[model samples]
Target: LEAINLRERKIIPAIKKGETVVLDFSHAITATHSFLTALLADPIKILGLKSYKQIKIIGANETIRTIIDF
Candidate 1:
């Protein structure tokens, strides 16, 4: 959770600065709902859906992609 929070802190600032943030999940096999939420919740809440425009996700498998989409 602390690590997730630290990543979120970095991500949010980059987004705010209008930089494109790429989240590469290339070798990750899966992710828990709670983990995803912890990583994304604050950015969504603070920046709204517009945050999606600044963030890019790549290399997630089907299941992980589905979870993120959901």
Candidate 2:
């Protein structure tokens, strides 16, 4: 929750201000659905699809990619 809050307050604002945001998922070998939702879902909701058109996600494995893409 703390991590999510920081991203919400800082990263989301940066993205909103027209900065490019790169989210690297390499450190985590696996991500739970709840973790992914908490980490990313709110930003998508707040920023909308148009804003995320250029966002980059790095090093996600197939399962993670499937969940995220779905």
CA lDDT of each prediction against the hidden true structure: 0.81, 0.76
Off by over 4 Å in 2: none
Residue-by-residue lDDT tens digits, candidate 1, 1-67: 8537755678888988888888888999998887877667668787888887887889999988988
User: After aligning candidate 1 to the native by TM-score, how far in Å is the CA of 39 from where it should be?
Assistant: 1.5
- The sequence of per-residue lDDT tens digits that candidate 2 reaches over residues 1-70 is 7548856777688788888777788886878887777667767787787656646789898888988887
Output the lDDT of residue 59, model 1: 99
lDDT of 1 at 63: 85
